[model samples]
Target: MHLYYEVSGNGKPVVLLHSGGADLRDWTYVVPFLANHYQVVAFDGRGAGNSPSPTEPANYVADLLALLDHLEIGQAAIVGHSMGGRIATDFALEHPDRVSELVVVGPALSGFNFSQEFQEWMQRINAAFPDIDKVIERSFDAPSYRIIKSSPHWELMIDMFRHHLKKTTEWGTFESVWPEPPAIDRLGDMQVRTMLLIGDEELPDNIRTAECFRDIPDFQSITIPGADHMVTLTHPNELCRHMIRFLGG
Candidate 1:
């Protein structure tokens, strides 16, 4: 399927990948900030926004490569959040020649090791009886959303959160067809400029992911004090600051 995408500005390509529940619109604030200096590309992944589901299984990394081909872009710097970050990492690994730089925010690595504490916590949570409304509430516990829960954007966030969570219930993890390998082991193979961003207030497991990549050559990481999983939405200006510093360097 041809995914829905939009491009803006006129310099190097900067592709934005939204989280699983999000569509292209999640980049609303970040896009303009980037478009001022780069050709920004934001797209709705398969089954999100206006993009229709593929006839077969979805291989997001392949889909991204195809999208670049369709746009006639030889290379791009990828910025992805959560699940989108996982895709960005996989694509950079599989097609190193096609990526110039890669950045991920609160990303979920395919085989990243979760601390025993985190794993047990998740097990406990998953073992409990499921409640749809409670599930939606739990989603807000993510640091970024927690910070924004009382803000002007709170209501809008609630709706978006509920929508995405519901979609997960309907579609499951969407991992049946196009499973990719764990990237932690391949960190040494990344050839492009790479940066990992994590919010200080985010879950402890995500914060620890930075330490996982610190030993790799040329890998850099930053922790945003007042931000969380949805840093792009909660702290776009701060996020842009790091981005401008890295991409412009």
Candidate 2:
């Protein structure tokens, strides 16, 4: 299935990919800012938003490459968050020439061991509720609920998660989808210019993920103090500013 994507502004191509639960809208605030300097293209991944879900993760990566081929973009800078970050790494690793620069936000690891604690945590989420509303509520709240409790996006976040929950049956959703965390070995050889962005308030593992790519020649990292996993939504301006500076806008 063709993924739904939007293009904004005009200039060098810059691609934006959203996290797992959310769609391209996650980049709403930042896309316009980046569009000022680059042609920003944001798309929803398979199983999220308008994109069709596939049981395989590699298929999703192929879908992204096909999208670029369709767009006739020889190369473009990529900015991905969470699951999108993982996808970005995979894409660059497989197609080194198509990527201009890579920026990963709160990037999830690849092929790394799933800690027993994290596995138990997943089990807890799996056991939460069969009801989509209850499960979405719990999944969304598991991260930034306390800090964004007063933010306007709290309702939007809940709504989005609930909508995603309904689209995929609760029984099959969690069971079918669990990303293989990134292996530190593969990241060491990532040839692209890479930037890892994380929030101080995000999970400890997320904070440490940036350090895993020390083998990449141009790897760099930055952290936002009060922001959490959903920092892109909370600190859109700051994120856009950093990206602009890094991409030499």
Candidate 3:
């Protein structure tokens, strides 16, 4: 696969799909714990981290399949955060047999209409594009990041956001292709065991998204106290503990 990826530990494969505005570094805290129990495959999605900029409209789902095929991973537990969670949900719906389990952390769901407030917030950031500093400032000002902004990992988060914003300037197109009819419309079709993990202090849009996933059969949801959107960074131990228990480690 053209995407850059790293594999660690050894056991049933588990793939990590990071949130937008960051890279595989989003898993920096969570990986060490999960790696000790299962083989962890974390990669930079197109146009993020070490991955090449998209020359055409990006197809994240196809890129994921290519990664699995390249690693010869027949099936894996798919774990995703934010935008990554949206991708994971679509992937499981499109290729159910390839996903042994599905876990979405503060996921964004396709076909779920985002609140105007959230859309406007994103627009403000986009308007500051090219001026990386302003964009970064606006991005972190969201209620979703209230906790992380004061956490020790704030610098790391800023670094990733800065890096991703810089890289976006090199992209040919910002469009990303997902499975048809949207994952939100296909939740009932998901066959893999699923889990939804979120922080108590999340944006309304994300909380609404989580509600959509609740209707899925055999689904479980957990809320991490004292965490916001960046639960992976602030509560890695707790996140890993819940994940391991759910995955039956």
True-vs-predicted CA distance for residue 7, candidate 3, Å: 0.7
* Deviation in Å, model 3, residue 218 alpha carbon: 1.3
Q: What's every prediction's RMSD, in angstroms?
A: 2.7, 2.8, 0.8
lDDT of residue 7 for candidate 2? 90
Per-residue CA lDDT of model 1 for 154-186, tens digit only, reads: 665666656655555554346534344577777
lDDT digits (tens) for residues 1-249 of candidate 3? 789999999998999999999999999999999999999999999999999999899999999999999999999999999999999999999999999999999998889998899999989988997788898889888788999999999999999988988898899998878778988878887798999999999989889999999778889999999999999999999999999998867
- Clash pairs (backbone) in predicted model 2: 109-181, 109-182, 110-181, 110-182, 110-183, 111-181, 111-182, 112-181
- Give candidate 3's error at residue 141 in angstroms: 1.1
What C-alpha lDDT, on a 0 to 100 scale, does residue 125 get in candidate 1? 46
> What residue runs in model 2 are displaced by over 4 Å at the alpha carbon?
55-58, 141-145, 170-183
lDDT of 2 by residue, 47-114 (tens): 77777655543355677789899899999998899878878887888788999999999887566565
TM-score of 2: 0.89
Deviation in angstroms for 219 in model 3? 0.4
Q: What lDDT score is found at residue 131 in candidate 1?
A: 73
Candidate 3: segments with Cα more than 4 A from true spot: none
TM-score of every model versus the real structure: 0.87, 0.89, 0.98
